[model samples]
Target: TVNELRRQRKLMEKLSMEDHLTGLPNRRAFFDCAERQVEFSKRKSEAMALLYLDLNDFKGVNDTLGHDVGDELLKSVGKRLSTVCRKSDLIARMGGDEFVYVLPSTGKKGSREAETRIHQAFEDPFSVKGRSLKLTASVGIAVFPDDGKTIRELLIVADEKMYENKEKLSRESKRVTIT
Candidate 1:
């Protein structure tokens, strides 16, 4: 029984980085992997990317539908995002409606491609609570060793970009004119 307990403990530790809800890696685990990538990039003098994303109109979904449906939608989004990302990429939920991704050994081109893929993933409809829901996400990206020398700075820049995207969307939403 003791050996069995030890084995189970090891398995749990291995899976600790994963988010139980969305099955994406959790924030703590993501940071651990990102730190390693940052160190490697520093040595090779290569560029890496950090992408910060937030679901657009997610709060409206919760308000219009319910929290249960909102949770299901998040899980679906995570699954779709995982399919679009490379095996080397790290995707994680930073709590609430926020997510962060790390693309090691990738620069501007890679970041652009990844962002495009993610946006395309959201173009499809998601089934939640037996209903279809359309969703969009705002993405902000920062390149390592160019945008910031530290992870904190990278996250701040990425968050700033995300907020800028949100503001743009809000402005666009108010611009529709009906004849």
Candidate 2:
């Protein structure tokens, strides 16, 4: 009886920690790990990076292809992100088309490398329901101490930068159209 109960508890704990769709860490689990990592980094005086990524034109996919296809795309994106990110790093879906990456002990070079890897991961088309769809993401990066001392502050800055990057892209596309 004790062993059975222990197994059930473990199952519940794992379920609580993972995203139902992507099987990646959920926001709660991610935040817990991120906070611990931040504290550790603070103690070691090491730099870390947090990246906020938003899928570009994700709403359009849902609008045109429907929710099923959108869900598939999201799952595929999550899988690819996991592959590109360091094994020690944590990638979590913050719901919808937004994802967060916690890169521990990552400096400027590692951050750029992670960014490049993430970009490259999306270069290949994702196949869903016998259809291949191209996708892109707007990424905002924040380094600890430089951007924020705390995880919450880092998230805020990263979110702002992500939106700013998306806005810049929008402006550039508009300029091209006007020209």
Candidate 3:
């Protein structure tokens, strides 16, 4: 009985850390891992990058295509992100079409490269339930020691930057429509 209980506990822990739909690490897992990474980076004096990404027009997709299709799209997005990231990188779903990436031992240049790769990955449409859906994400990046000393602080900065990027895109789209 004790062994079975232990096994159940282990399973529960694993499930708690993973996003059920996308199979990516959940927010709690991200924070737990990020805290350790931040400490390691500080000890080694290494640069790290935190990226906050939010899907653009995700709500529209859910409303138009139904939740099942939206869920599939999230899973596809997760897989796409995994393909673009290195073995060392940490990718997590921060719930509801928002994801976070932790790049250890990476600086501004590396972050920019990663961001470019992510954009390129989105160039192809994701197929969900026999439908082709185009998706884009607004990414905000913050480098360690430059942006913040702690993971929470870095996340805050990254989230703010992501919102700014989303606003810029919205404005640019409006301008293009007007012209």
Candidate 4:
């Protein structure tokens, strides 16, 4: 009984640190991991990047295909991100079709390259169950020291940049559709 209790506790702890849908790290876990990465980057005098990403037009998927399909798409996105990003990178689900990545020791060039890889990841349509769906995300990158020294500051700046990119994409999409 004691062993069972301990096992259950450990499972609970793991679950607490993970996102239920994507199986990526939850926001709290991300913060913990990123805090350490930030310290490491600072000590080493290495530039790091915080990437904030938001799914484009994700609500449409949920509306047309239902929540189950939407959830599967989210999972697929997480998998694709892992494939493109470095193993050392820290990825987290920031809830509601948003994610964040902490790329330690990556400066502007590396972050840009990672962002391009991220875009390429979505070039192929996702096969979720029976439906084939295309997805894209707006990614914002903020380099450490130049952008922000601390995780909190970096996150805030990245988030703002992501929203701006999202808006720009939305406008471009609208214009194309209109024309």
Candidate 5:
């Protein structure tokens, strides 16, 4: 009976830290790990990068294609990100159509390279429910010690940058359309 209780507890803990849809670490898990990483970076005098990624036009996908297809798209996105990231990197789903990545011992240059790879990963269409769907994400990167000292502070900076990036992309698309 005790062993069974322990197993249940372990499963609960795992479920608590995981996103049900994508099976990636959830927001709670990301924050917990990120806090530790930030402290480690501070103690070791190492640089770290926080990337906030928000899918562009994700709501449209759900609206047009249905939730099942949208869910498949999110899972595919997670798999792509996992492939792109290193073992040392921490990638998590931060709720609907949003993900966050923590790159330990990485600076601005490394973050930019990671961003490029992420964009490249999305270049190909995602096949879900026999339909090929195109998607892109707005990525915002913040380097530790340069951007913020705490995880929450870094997230705030990264979120703001993500919005800025999204706006920039919107403007660029509008310009292209106008031309």
Candidate 6:
């Protein structure tokens, strides 16, 4: 029993920075690493970027289906997001259908490409419990030094931008519905 407990504890440590549900880095893990990266950028005078993302209509799925389905959807989204990012980039799930990407040594052009890739990743349908569901993610981007000097400030700006993007998406969705 002691050995098993130890093993479990080690596993948790390895995964401690990640969300157990989606297998994406948790906020703690993301921010810890991101802060270091920001400091490095500051020291080196290199560029960096932060991307904030949120799933639209995710709550509707959870309400219409169940938590199990909702969780599966989140996992799929996480996987797709990972596929979109570069090997050097960091993708983390902040919590509850929200995710972020930390782009180190990246410029505005690179950040734009990353954002576009992430958006394209969600273009396909997600299959859950034999059902094909469509979803979209709103992305907010903040460039390093250009947007803010520190990780905390960058994140705050990114989050604000994310909400603005989400609002745009909502308006588009409503327009389509009305049409």
Best by TM-score: 5
Clashes of each: 0, 0, 0, 0, 0, 0
Instruction: Please give the lDDT score at residue 66 for candidate 1.
Output: 87
Off by over 4 Å in 4: 174-179
lDDT of 1 by residue, 97-148 (tens): 8999899989999999999998899877888878888778899999999999
**How displaced is residue 176 in candidate 2, in Å?**
18
Candidate that beats the other on lDDT, 1 or 5, i.e. the better one? 5
Residue 58 accuracy (lDDT) in model 1: 86
| Residue pairs in collision within model 6 | none
Q: Give the TM-scores of the predictions, in the order they appear.
A: 0.92, 0.93, 0.94, 0.93, 0.95, 0.91
Q: What lDDT score belongs to each candidate, Candidate 1 first?
A: 0.87, 0.88, 0.91, 0.88, 0.91, 0.88
Q: Tens digit of lDDT per residue, candidate 5, span 89-156?
A: 99999999999999999999999999999999988888787888777889999999999999999999
Cα displacement (angstroms), candidate 5, residue 57, comes to 0.3
Off by over 4 Å in 1: 174-179
- Regions more than 4 Å wrong, model 3: 174-179
Candidates 3 and 6, the one with greater lDDT: 3
Alpha carbon lDDT at 165, candidate 1: 90
Give residue 103's error in model 2 in angstroms: 1.0
Cα lDDT tens digits, model 2, 1-179, are: 99999999999999999999999999989899999999999999999999999988888788888999889989999999999887889999989999999999997778878888898998778888878888778888999978999999999999999899889877765210100
lDDT of 3: 0.91
Per TM-score, what order, best first? 5, 3, 4, 2, 1, 6
Residue 146, candidate 3: C-alpha displacement in angstroms: 0.2
* TM match of model 1 to true structure: 0.92
